[model samples]
Target: MKGKLAAAMRNLGLCVALAGLTACASGPMDVSGTTPGPLSIASEGSFFIGGHDVHSDTLSTVPNYATSGTVTVGQVYVSYQVPTHARPLSLTLIHGCCLTGKTWETTPDGRMGWDEYFVRHGFPTYVIDQADRGRSATDIETINAVKEGKAPVTALPALFAASHEAAWAIFRFGPQYPQRFPGEQFPLDSQSGLWQQMVPDWIASLPTPNPTVPALSQLAAKLRNTVLISHSQAGIYPFQAAALSPNGIAAIVALEPAECPSATGDLTPYTKIPILVLFGDYIDQSPRWAPRLNACRAFADAAVRAGGHVQLVLLPDVGIHGNTHMMMQDRNSLDVANWVLHWIDTHVTAAAS
Candidate 1:
């Protein structure tokens, strides 16, 4: 078929483009919101930040278990890719509760995720696993000690894992499981992919604001001109980071945040940096989400009153519909990403000058 032949030719072209990484590093980027182009990657690597080592209760002589009676925990892991001639601002993405950096990765239908999308658009991209999640290691000694009766049962860290049934409601798929909102964009058939991303969240044990907040500040300082993009439970980190240290932070993009910085808190931290609070559809019908939306609205209003650059947008108002909490993994994820990219270009880059 003609379509199949065209597809094969385009695939061949992409391979050719990828092979030209260093040679065409400054090639024109694709901002048209279609399949990205100039697939050149100049550098790609990962690192860990924040956290500290804790003394382990049991010291073992086993080769793999050997340590100086200390184990490293609470460090946040970051994977970064810098395209040749990357834009001035770098994007740092953090995931929600029960998720990892994987939230910004390939969609359930195997479509391109935001990480690769931004890189193709000529911006350095960094994906983070919040402290104690995924590649960001956590302390197991407390759990081990509790099980061994060496530590009191109260010492067991509070870990919360969402059931698929609960996620149905939490993610706003519908009033409950086995149901979906009308015109929903989430890929129903590939739900197993979503479940695969859900992990045990041990946030209750972590310090308030989470170690990732300070680590995010450190990363922002390192990356310089960084735009933080967070979702769900991890949403408040950027605001906290900005308060902790506003240097090097260019902007904040929060997607369906669980909570916003209190309206009563010092609003001076956000006075310069642009902030966007985005939400998907059906919040009016969601008992939990409605209140959250109201709270975010209040914070945005307060931030604006405090002379901060804050704006709130509901997807439906912008004609993007049927998105659940995990908008990055939705069927039209690239469209969503393109919109956010446009915001960065307009607000951060333009405002800088």
Candidate 2:
């Protein structure tokens, strides 16, 4: 007993087994004969450059404020993690609208999220809060301009938040909270906590060359061959970023994307990079998601025709059901994550072969 306690202290890690017994250093060890990492953050910082250099003479009669040229537009925050024995591949998780990198952290149900899960499974992980969302800073001036009708915006409409009912329907959570589909995998008991995560929506900055594209592209360029896992409103970001810098992305896993690139657009950038589009159950029931699915299918078809490798996975077809758009927070979220891990492994193997 003394020796076991000593070892536990040495490893300084604990795992709860199925038998409900606490074990220390009882699992697979790394090449160094140590337990796998516990998702330590390797680095974290914001990618920002919305400020003009303040240029003014040291001695100016005019007020320094007037002479100074300083204005900050925005910044995107990124958090990175690496396992003790990480695989060669890396993953970047991009959250959807009304969410942040927190979406990949602990779920409302108190389960470890994909960020930690992937790291434990040997993949370096990067979680991003896109510019103007979450931890990333936003430009109040730009937003106020749109709100005050001072900006000539061509594409995006005014941003707004959804009521609980509206969000329920939008998320395809059975038209109402606590009234989920039969055999629903979501933890309905935790609905209150989950609902608390809902944040006000940011303006859709699609037209006028959205700044997010360039910021995301810059992030991709900074990382070495990354696999993007984007969800919902963030689905098309990977495509755009990859198109901007084809060499950066190794692959993409888009979950219930709100949009996809046009089938008519050039897909040359995606030819070498593989893509997997995953859809959950209850999609057919949502009037909103039907067209999105069709668009994604068309995009996949176009990608395939362009000599790109793309696969679409439907949860129900694989015997997994009762999933909603927020599958990451569902009771079967671990199962879904396992499937994604398997897909990533397969891709890695294919690349090696």
Candidate 3:
């Protein structure tokens, strides 16, 4: 009788197998369970040497050969969560001038950054610390040489450093520090963190055929049809990468790019790729930025005339206000991200679907 009852319960799926024992199952069991994690991390770190040399030093206590090299370093760190459902695109975030990938990792005010948000929302986001910045490493000797009015002995590029006060006005946080626009979105209390993002930038390293372009292009190629999101000085990077590989980048979202393809530069390469240029508030009011913004407009206009798909979005015209150049770190950053996501959904994913 006991054996018959046990068999009957097993047939009805009420038994849980255990060591030398069987217990009654508790309600319905989850047959298809999800894994806790084996979260994968893909990281790249390296110094790409431009030149190498040996030097002799006589004042050494121990006999050691002195060696130096002209090199630029690159670090691309990425963590991705596959979308709950399939999506057709990924994102490669490039930081602007003087900043590193950490800029997108967290806001100055300690809010969740765009990188984690996008990854959580299903986009496989890749963040890069461009050559000679952030975790990648920099050539300080090169920087000091430039400061001392010395030209580089090798053909290697030079990096230029900017002042914090200048960045204050230039970023349009305000004309100067401690004097911000009324109701500005940037977190004034965390201004020091923002300043920490500033690093020396390589001159002549972002245009097409430059070493930096190829370095970033390689990353894009690995991503297979990624969308590039660039800010400030990095704005030229996507254009150069896309122009070089043409088919590597699926689209581009440039946030207040400091550089634009010259009006005379070829736009034919970008004709098929969708591009969006976003400008924060106070652009027109900024004497330092107004002229640059004008040039950007001309480039966008010219691109459109040449059959490129381009849209220049001004935040103020769209009802957002008091945003500095660092809108991603602004209070309403998520709102701006939503706009960008919508663009990606409509232009890239929708079309791919």
Steric overlap count per candidate? 0, 0, 1
Quantify all predictions' global Cα lDDT against the true fold: 0.84, 0.71, 0.69
Model 2, which residues run further than 4 Å from truth?
A: 1-69, 142-157, 176-178, 205-207, 349-353
Query: What C-alpha lDDT does candidate 1 achieve relative to the native structure?
Result: 0.84
In candidate 2, position 148 carries an lDDT of 47
Residue 163, candidate 3: Cα error in Å is 2.6
Q: Order of candidates by TM-score, top first?
A: 1, 2, 3
As a TM-score, model 2 comes out at 0.79
Pairs that collide in candidate 2 are: none
Q: Quick one: best TM-score, which candidate? A: 1
Alpha-carbon deviation at 9 in model 2, angstroms? 12
Tens digit per residue, CA lDDT, model 2, 179-257: 6677767777787766787776664643344556666777766776688899998899888888888766778999999
Give the lowest summed-lDDT range of ten residues in model 2: 51-60
Over 84-164, each residue of candidate 3 has an lDDT whose tens digit, in order, gives 332457887888877888878778877767876665445667777766566655445444444445545563464577787
Question: TM-scores of the models, in the given order?
Answer: 0.88, 0.79, 0.74
